[model samples]
Target: MKIAIIGAGGVGGYFGAKLVKAGHDVHFIARGEHLKAIQNNGLVVKSILGDFRVANLRATEKITEIDQPDLIILGVKAWQIKEIREDIRKVLHKDTVILPLQNGVLAADELSEKIDKRNVLGGLCRIISKIESPGVIHHIGVTPTIVFGELDKSITERISGIDRIFKSAGIESTISEDIEADVWRKFILICVSGLLAVSETTYGELRETKETRQLMIGLLNEIFLLSKKAGVKIESDFVGKAVAFIDTFPPSSTSSLTRDVWDQKPSEIEYQNGSVVKMGEKHGIETPINKFVYSCILPRELKARGLR
Candidate 1:
């Protein structure tokens, strides 16, 4: 199948390179040094599974250069969505499926408004990865999983074909029965960890301190309640399972958002924790813990961008 990867950052870069290595026709839409590197050499993926390079890869900054792809994996940051919507539309065929592997819960709906509902699929990605450098993608975790399904919950040949391709590339891809719920579950995990990591000093600091740990759990509970109120059918013990998962991680484990905030790079906080705050307000739910975390991170965000 012809595949196009938008925003060839860590998520797209790693998965797209793997698909290319698996002998699939993959085109990466990227810009700046990362695009130059992929065009000059290839997309490099350094992961715990293995390290490899796809030398015969196709890459371009504009979508018009590539043919219509069967699947377009949208991996851009949440902030870049509005800017790239039309650009992304240019590369899709009538039957092309756009799977957004973004962090927030609103991307699928937002994209659906621009593109045909049938052409957009809801996706949730579970991986600890980042752009280690301009051309390098570093995946830190063992499981690199992706879950996607049709917006209307219909199973189609295209979804099956995409699933086969992903599995061929050694990725664990599932066709979720309820993609929206899956997306929210992932958001809860990421936002809780992200806010705590940034608000405190590090993951170790949050996990080691009793007060911070309780606060982290409380923040997660608030988001979970908001999700329930939003009508998402999340598991009852979701928070308990999440806390246990965090305990298994190395004490030094931190979210990518925390790293971005610390490095003064742009972050997706407005979509993560800020999303919870906005949704809670809409539902008349009091999210004091999440609100507190959001407030704490705002100063750092302002400071990082010299807005303070």
Candidate 2:
């Protein structure tokens, strides 16, 4: 398959490396020093599962330079989706599939608005990874996994074929019968990202303290109520499971959102917890915890963009 991986960050770089290693024709769309490093040194991924490199890779900053891609995986943030979709459209064919392995729930919707909805898939990824340096990706922890499916929750030939493509690369992939529920399940896990950023708390800090743990639960409960009101199906008892999952994390583990805020880089503050708050307002639900978290980060987020 001829694949295009946009945004060669942690998520994109790691997954694209896997595809290229599997002997697929992959085009990496990236910019800055990262793109230069890849063009010179190839793409390197250090995974707990295994480490590998794709030498002499096909990489370009211009998406138009690549020929038609059978599949396009968006590894960019949700906020950058609209901006990148124009370039993505230039290289897509009629049956080209677009998968967004972003942090928030809204990436697919954002892409579908400008690009063809028929080509966009509801997708999310579970991976603890980061760009260790230019052209080098580090999968520090977690069993990297990809979950995706059609928006309408129907299983089809294309879904199975896409699942096969990822699995063939030794990626743990799933085709969900309830992709909505699956997406929300991951959202439940990510709700702690804002709290961790604001408090600079680690997983050990949040899980070990009764008060902090309960506060984390409160933020999650607000999201649960909002999801229920919005008519998105999530496992009824998933909250308890989510809390347990956090307990399993390493003591110093933090989220991508927390790291971005700490680095004063642009983050998904508006798309993650902020998305929950917006959905709450739309459904006449009071998301006090999420609202508080969103408000706490708004100043920093605004300042990050020079909006202050």
Model 2 pairs whose backbones collide: none
What is candidate 1's lDDT per residue for 216-260, written digit by digit as tens? 898889989999999999999999988887766555667778887
Error of 2 at 157 (Å): 1.2
lDDT of 2 by residue, 76-193 (tens): 8778987888888888899999999887788888888788899989999998788889999988778889999999899989889988889999999999988878888888789799
Model 1 lDDT, full chain set = 0.83
Which window of 10 residues has the lowest lDDT sum in candidate 1? 193-202
Give the C-alpha lDDT of model 2: 0.88
lDDT of 2 at 38: 97
Clashing pairs in 1: none
